[model samples]
Target: MSSQLLMIEDDTRLAEMVGEYLGQSGLHVTHRADGKSGLAQLQGPEAGPLPDLVILDLMLPDMDGLEVCRRIRSLQGPAAQVPVLMLTAKGDPMDRIIGLELGADDYLPKPFEPRELLARIRAILRRRTDGGTPAATPALRFGSLEIDRDARTVTVGGQVADLTSYQFDLLVTLAERAGRVLTRDQIMEAVRGRELDAFDRSIDVHMGRIRAAIEADAKNPRRILTVRGVGYVFAKQQD
Candidate 1:
């Protein structure tokens, strides 16, 4: 079955172009012009099954994309867990960082190539699919924190931790390699099969979000520790 994608973009021409282009690759694309209608579709009963992913534009006529993301994350059950890929026209890094902080799975700046967008979509969906496969050890436990690979869930002290799909995969990558210090590039490559930009701090932003979700105290993270002048390590000993 073709993967379903909901693109919440106000740019009619761009939406048409993206929909058509992605259609060629066996994806079903649905477009909603503004944030409200897009969100309505997700919340409406007649909308049927939710889309596999969402492509959201940062600048919306109805609301800020960050607000939309926040609302989506606050929704109940499966709707809240839907992966979001944000499209940002702004050149500011803060917008992207804020999007990630609000549970966006990824972001693409404006003027990006269509192929790059397609690749990013594939990577996100692939992570979701890959994460469900049964493994030798389906779950990882570090002290009170538990990571279930097959179920794609993280729990701290028996309480479920809210993490975006991308963040969940990132946590799994580090937990699987517990005790090893992996550079940002190495970590990105492990999770996304792509090298990180030399100056990209997206991984750090994501790490902070992950810490907030699973750590007893985000200020003093015990599971994921950052090495000064290096990358990060998932401590073998925790809590």
Candidate 2:
């Protein structure tokens, strides 16, 4: 089935633009110009053909974007699985951080080119479906850290590590292709299904957090080594 996308934005022009753009990219697009209506549509009893992703504008006339995000997350069963990508005019660093912390799969600042938005949508969707069986999962070990493919979880010293979905994916990607020098672009595509833009710092920040969780020290991480000009690699042996 073609991926379905739902866009919630009060701006009619922007909504139309996004719908047309995404539709052209082979996705079924459903749009709502109001938050209340959008929420109702998603929460409706019929639930015919649930959306694969939600592109939500932060400034909704009827409600705060964070509140809308919270509501979407509260849904049970299938509805709860939908991934959200937040759109906002505010380019504040804090805003982006908060959005990610709030369970948004991704965030895009306003005035972005339509193509970039389309790229992001495709990337997010691809990342969601890239996983395969057995051979696909990487067996990585750093120090006492180990990632189990069958279990789909990470453990440090045999204890489960509290990792976010994205973190786990990143770890698995690097672990599976251990010792290979992967550039940022390669890492981004493998983990996020897209290239890393010049300003995209989410991966680095995420790596830092992951290191903190798995490594005895994060300031100078060892398990995941950064090659500076290039990207990063999972060491063949614990350092």
TM per model?
Answer: 0.96, 0.70
The true-versus-predicted C-alpha distance at residue 148 of model 2, in Å, is: 6.5
Q: Tell me how far the alpha carbon of residue 172 in candidate 1 is from the true structure, in angstroms, after superposition.
A: 0.8
Residues 1-239, candidate 1: write the lDDT tens digits: 89999999999999999999999999999999998888887887537789999999999999989999999999887999999999987578999999999999999999899999999999999988854546556589998999988788899999999999999999999999999999898999998899998978999999999999999889998889999888999999967
Candidate 2 lDDT over 146-189, as tens digits, reads: 89765657999988775555677788889888899888888878
Candidate 1 residues lying further than 4 Å off, grouped into runs, are: 131-136
Supply every candidate's count of residue pairs whose N, Cα or C atoms clash at under 3 angstroms: 0, 0
Model 1: lDDT to the true structure: 0.92
Rate residue 215 of model 2 by lDDT: 82
* CA lDDT of each prediction against the hidden true structure: 0.92, 0.78
**The best candidate in terms of TM-score:** 1
